[model samples]
Target chain A: MPLARRIIPCLDIKNGRVVKNVNFHHGTWDAGDPVELAAMYDRQGGDEVVFLDINASWEQRSATLDILTRAAEQVFIPLTIGGGVTAVEHVRSYLRAGADKVSINTGAVKDPDLINQSAEIFGSSTIVIAIDMKRRPTGGWEVYLQGGRTPTGIDGLKWAEEAWRRGAGELLVTSMDADGTRNGYDMELHQALANLVDIPVIASGGAGTLDHIAEVLTTGKADAALVASIFHSGQYTVDDAKQYLAAKGVPVRR
Target chain B: MAARIVIVDYDMGNLQSVRNAFKAVGYQAEISPDPASVLHADGIVLPGMGAFGNGMRKLAERDLIDPILEFATGGRPVLGICLGMQLLFEYGEEYGGGPGLGLLTGRATRLPDTVKLPQIGWNLVEPVAAAHPIFEGLDQPYYAYFDHSYAAADVAPADVAAVTDYGRVFPSVVARRNIIGIQFHPEKSSRVGLQMLTNFGRIVCHSRSTLR
Candidate 1:
C-alpha cells in the first residue's frame, strides 16, 4: 500500500498567537496559543502541523521560532514552518529551532533559484513550496504573494510546475476562491496541479466537513488536506475528520 | 542510574527532538559529537537526515567513522535513525554512489517517484521479527511517521525487524546484535515512538547489567 493520506492542522500564527482571517484578509480572529493548540492536535493524532507566520514580516520571525521551539518540545509529530522564509539561513534557523520542514512562498517567487539553493543545502525534503492562488476573471488562477494580497501575475499552475522542477519536495496550494466559503476545495485546481507534478500536493482552503476532506483526498487526488477554522474553533477535531475519512475508505493515519 | 543516552551528532539529524523524546521517557539524553561521549555512553543513537553523501562526509570530517564502528562492535546498544539508518548499510545510490559505514550489508537507494517523492506522513509498521524487545508492548501494524525519498534496498531479510509499505515493501526497522536502525523517526511518531525509545533504554540497562 501507499503512505496513508495526511491530515494536517494549520496554525496561522501572528505575534505568537494562533489567529485566522477570512480569505487571508479583513481582520484577524484569535484562535488560541500556538503551542497549546498544537499539543492538543498532537493528542488528537494529527499527522502533521503547519505553522504559517501569516504576518509575513522578518521582525516577528524570532518570536515565531521561539514559539516553534516551545511547541516542538510539547509535540512529537512533524512541524512545518512558513512565512517570511527568504533564504537558506532562514531555513537553517527554523530547522534548528525545531521545524522539520520549511515552506517558502514570496522568497521563492522573488528568486526562483532560492528553491534550488535551499534544496541543495538543506535537502529537498526539508523544503516545501507554498502557492497562494485566487481565481482570475480571465480564467486560470493567478499566484499571489505577501499573504495573498499582491498578485505576481504568474500563472499558478505554470509556476507550480517550475517550482517542482527546481527541487521543491512538496506543494501546499491554497485557493482564495474557496477560502472562508466552506463550499469545498477547488477540485479542478487541485486535480490539475496534482496531475502536473509528481511531488505530493497538500490541498488547503475551503473545508467545512469531513466529506470535503475525503473528496479532496480521493477524487481531488490530494495526498494531504490542510484544515483551519473548523478544527481551530472546535467544530470538529482532527480525530473526527480522520475517523470520517477512514470510514469512507480513504486511508488515513489513525 | 538512568541509561546515559548520547545522540551521535554528526550535524545531520534533528538531534534536539531526538534528545527531547528520550528525556520524555525518563532517560538522560545529550547530543554530543564528542567521541568520548559515544565511548562512555550506556547507549548511543546515531541520528541523521538529508543526503547520504553529505551525511557520510560529515561523519568522515568529524573523524567519527571509526569511533562509531568501535562503539557498535563493543556490544553496547547503538541505534541509527533515518539517513543514519541508511548510513549503517554498505553503500548508497544517492547522488550517483557512495560508501556508507558498512555496519550492515545493504544498499540505500531512492524510492520510485511512481508513488511520490519524499513519502511523508504516518504509515503502519509490520514486524518481520515477532519477538524483538524494541516493540515489546506495541501493537502489530503500529503506525510510525516517515519522511524520506530513499530507503534501504538490499539488506538481509534476517536483519529486518519490521517492514512498512509505500510503493513496495521496504525495511523500516533493522537490527543485528547490539546495533538497531529505524527508517522512521521514532521521535516524531508520538506514543508508539516514546514506547520504542523506552524499550531501547531498557535494552541498554539490561545489557549493562549483563556486562557487569
Candidate 2:
C-alpha cells in the first residue's frame, strides 16, 4: 500500500492554553491545556499534532516552548510547533525543545530567504511553510499573513511554487473562506495547490465531518487533513475519524 | 544495574526527543558528544536527521565515526535511527553522494520518482526475519512513522529484518549481528516503537550478562 493519509489534530494555543476560533477570529474559547490535549490526541492515534501559537506574542513564546517540552515528554508522535517563528534561532529553539518540525508563515513571507536559510541549516524536512489563503474577489486565491490579518497581493499558487523552490519541505495550506464553517474544505483551492506542488500539502480550515476529511484527502489530493474545531468540539475523536476513513476505503495507519 | 545507553550527539539534529522517547519507555538514555563515553557505553544509539552527506560530515568532524564503528564491531548492540540508519550503509546517493560508515553492505538511494519525495507519514512494516529480537512481542505488518526520501537499496536479504513499501520494497529494518538500523524513527512511532526500544534495552542487558 502507499503511504497512509495523515490525520493531524491542531491545537490553537493562546497564553499557554489551547483555544478555538472561527475563521481566525471571533468566538475564541478555551479548549484545554495544550499539553493534555496533545497527549490525548497522541493516544487517539493522531498521525501528528500541531500546536499553533495563534496569539504568538513575545511574552507567550516561552509558554509555547514550555508546552512543547512537556508534550514531547509524553507524546511520542511527531509534534509540529508554529507561530512567530521568524529566524533560524526560533527554528533551532523549537527543535531543541523537541519539535519535530517548525512551521513558518509570516516570517517566510517577510523574508523569503528565511525558508532557504533555515532549510539549509536544518534540512528542508524540518521547515514547514504554512500559507493562509483567502479567495480573491477577482477569483484566484491570495496569501494572507500576520495570522490572517494582513493580505499579500501575491497569488497563492505562485507563492507556493516559490516556497517549494526556496526549500520548503511541506506546505500547510489553510483556506480562510472555508475555515470555521464546518462545511468542508475548499476542494478547488487544495486541488489546485496539490496539483501544482510536488511536496506534500496538508489541507486545513473546514473539516466538519469524517466525509469532509475523506473527501479532502481523496478528491482534494491532500496528503493530510488538519482538523481543529471538529476534534476540539468533541464532535469526533481522532480514532473515530480514522475508523471512518478506513471504512470508506481511505488507507489510514490503523 | 541499568544499561548505559548513550545517544551520540554529532550536532545532526534533535537528540532530546530520542532521549525523551527512551525515558518514556522506562530507560535512561544520555545525550553525549564525548567519544570516550560512546565507546564505553553498554549500548550506543546513533540518531540523526538531514542529508546523508551533511550527516556524515558532522559525524566525521566530531570524530565519532571511528568510535561508533569500533563499538558496532565490538559485539555491543548499536542502533541507528532515520538518517543515522542510512549512515550504516556503504554509500548514499543524496547531495552529491558520499561514503557511509560501511557497516552494512547496501547503499542509500532516493525513492523512485513515481512516488512523492520525502514519503512522510505512517506505513506498514512487515517483518522479514521473524526471529529478530526487534520484532519480539510485535505483530506482523505493524505500522511505524517514517519520514525520509532515501532508504537502503541493495541490502543483502539475509541482513534485512523487515521491509516497507513506498514506490518499491526497501529495507526498512536491517540487522547484522550486533548492529541494527531502522529507517523509521521508532522514537516517534508510538507504543510499537516504544516496544522496539524496550526490546533493544533487553538485548543490551542480555549481552551484558553473557559477557560476564
lDDT of 1 by residue, B38-146 (tens): 8888889988888899999998998888888898888989899999899999999999989999999899988876777688778889988868888889757888998
Q: What is the interface RMSD of each candidate, in Å?
A: 1.2, 1.1
- Docking level for model 2: high
Chain A fold similarity by TM-score, each prediction: 0.98, 0.98
Q: For model 2, what fraction of the real interface contacts is kept?
A: 0.85
Q: Using Cα atoms with residue i matched to residue i, what is each candidate's TM-score against the true structure?
A: 0.96, 0.96
Stretches off by above 4 angstroms in model 1 are none
Model 2: per-residue lDDT, tens digit, B19-96? 988898888998999899988899999998888998999888989999998988889999999999999999999989
Q: In candidate 1, what are the lDDT values of residues A65-138, reduced to their tens digit?
A: 89989988889889999989888888999999999999999999999999999988887888899999998999
True contacts kept of 1: 0.77
User: Which candidate gets the maximum DockQ versus the true structure?
Assistant: 2
